[model samples]
Target: MIDLLKAKKLIFLLVIVISSFLIITGCGRDSGADIQSAEDNSFIMNTLVQMRAHGENAEIAVEESMDRIREIEYLMSRTLEASEVSQINDNPGEFIEISEETQKVIAESLYFAELSSGKFDPSIGPIVDLWGIGTEEARVPSQAEIEEVLEFVDYNNLEIEDNRARVTKEGVKIDLGGIAKGYAADEVREIVKKHDVPSAFINIGGNVLVVGNNVDGSKWRIGIQDPRRGRGNVMAIVESKDQTIVTSGDYERYFEEDGEHYHHIFDPESGYPARTGLLSVTIITDLSLDADALSTIAYVKGLEAGMKFVEDIADVDAMFITEELDVHLSSGLTGIVEITGPDFNLIEGENFAD
Candidate 1:
């Protein structure tokens, strides 16, 4: 449940996290040098990569990597008839055989669901569909309709065994939109890393995963975008060697009618958007997947509560922007997160407890 006010003010869309280059492992010791390539496809809704020995057979490696990404997209897509997720949605309460790839994602989703106290539930597909904010036909959903949809959003209803998952509840639905891109990014990074590319950065549209710094070994600098623009307007820049900067904002995806604004990211309790005072939450963590989930949770939890929530979590730093554009930070991230642009200000907090 990301804060309703922040969600209303923030609109987000799914973006791919494909890096510009690949990481070359054992670069100087093998048969020729290894080079990495990036590919964008409509099929996976993200980017793909492959690193091969720099020789005549490099094209084959590139093509194979692209195809591997497509295969993953086919198996995990919710819109596809043959996708495991679609099948699960089609036949609830039945065990669905899924690829180990899909299973890993499910496990991570469940882990974050527990960590966020169900605030970052992935079972928000019904509510998402009802609002239709990210689609062409976006509209506000009624209270009764949202309430009915909420009944199907219990993340605990999903049961996983080995490589299969079973949805015990009838109407229970799952949507990986929040965490899918990050997971996909992580997967591609591993794929490229195994191939031994020199250095890389995966920008799944906006969700960025840095495998290594620039080719010269400098820290990768990523600019946090300003939420109130169509272009990718950066608010500030964060430098990291090999880490992720994931942001969840109210301006990423949304629609306006009369004076009301509606978007995705609903609270399970009220079946409406969360009411947290923050406008957006950005997480910086070693793992992009965790950063992605925590951004949603922090956005829903507001300033104080969100700060406390992230404090207990180790090795994770957060930057929170409130509705009025006030910026707050977790202790570890205080001075390191600089505010850039005309609309942001840094403020200190005495205590941020729920």
Candidate 2:
């Protein structure tokens, strides 16, 4: 009878051990699945701003990041009467007090204008307003009108001191449309970091800034938009981490008239849409602001010069899609870029080194 009792006691302890092991294993699986993902979006900066994050307070972090974007839009938009940009534009000849954000943006704009030799100018506002390419009133402006506004499109006429800015030329206006979204992306990144988010990404109308790697600690795959195809159609893919990707394409903001497509990217010299022999230019860099401004500058520089320009810059990679659907990538992106669409031919940029 004692021997029988010993056997039963051993069985009971074995059962308890098995049950504990199963419970622990089940909790381990649940912990892996508990990594939550949250996403939120808002329409701001004249584009759709999206935020995706993975963490404990991801929802709250996304909400706060979007609020920061809206605040930037309100401060920088030229259409808003009370915006600092409008205030500077409304009083062109006089020094007007502006916010610190406005001052910083203007300062950065001037730097880029000098860097690109005026290829990316903030003083092209008058010309942009005349064409109104993205607005309902978009129409072809006459050559006479173009020439008249061309005089007021010089970036050198603008001056900044402390928190004040002045446009020496009368009727000269400043527009932040080209670089504002990029700045807003940087701001969103800061907020996400403050929330201790391990991984996050912000897409402000295709100006994407990835905060870190994927949840699995892998690189994020970013698609290069096919300029000729519809939205979400990509010609190639770029895998990266903690980078900003900005693309300037003819198809992004354009209007069709008489079978000719006129895009929003204008030449400061011609006061007309740039005919740069390229369909789109994508810039990848550490800062979204640099990527944003460089994409426009490279698009304006055309294919040959654009390729050289990107190669000369440090810590910058670019992908150029030509009119013939040829894909060209900078030296930095030679091995990293993969052509996904069969319609496009890959013309490696390393072959063009001078």
The regions of model 1 sitting more than 4 angstroms off are 1-43, 46-69
lDDT of 2 at 236: 80
TM-score of 1: 0.82
Report the lDDT of model 2 for residue 127: 89
Q: In candidate 2, list every pair of residues with a backbone clash.
A: none
> Best lDDT goes to which candidate?
2
Please identify model 2 stretches exceeding 4 Å from their true place.
Answer: 1-32, 349-353
Give a tens-digit lDDT track for model 2, residues 1-354.
112443344334433321110111122334436777788756678766667788887888898998888888888999999998888888868899988888989999999999899999999999899998876677898999999999899999999999899898778999989998999888888888898888888888879888777666667778887788656577788877888899999977777788788889999999999998999999999999889899999999998888888889999988999999988888888789888889999985255558
Clashes of each: 28, 0
For model 1, residues 4-39, the per-residue Cα lDDT tens digits are 564433223222222222122232343333443443
Residue 216 shift from truth in candidate 1, angstroms: 3.5
Judge candidate 1 at residue 62 and give its lDDT.
42
Given candidate 2, what's the lDDT at residue 197? 87
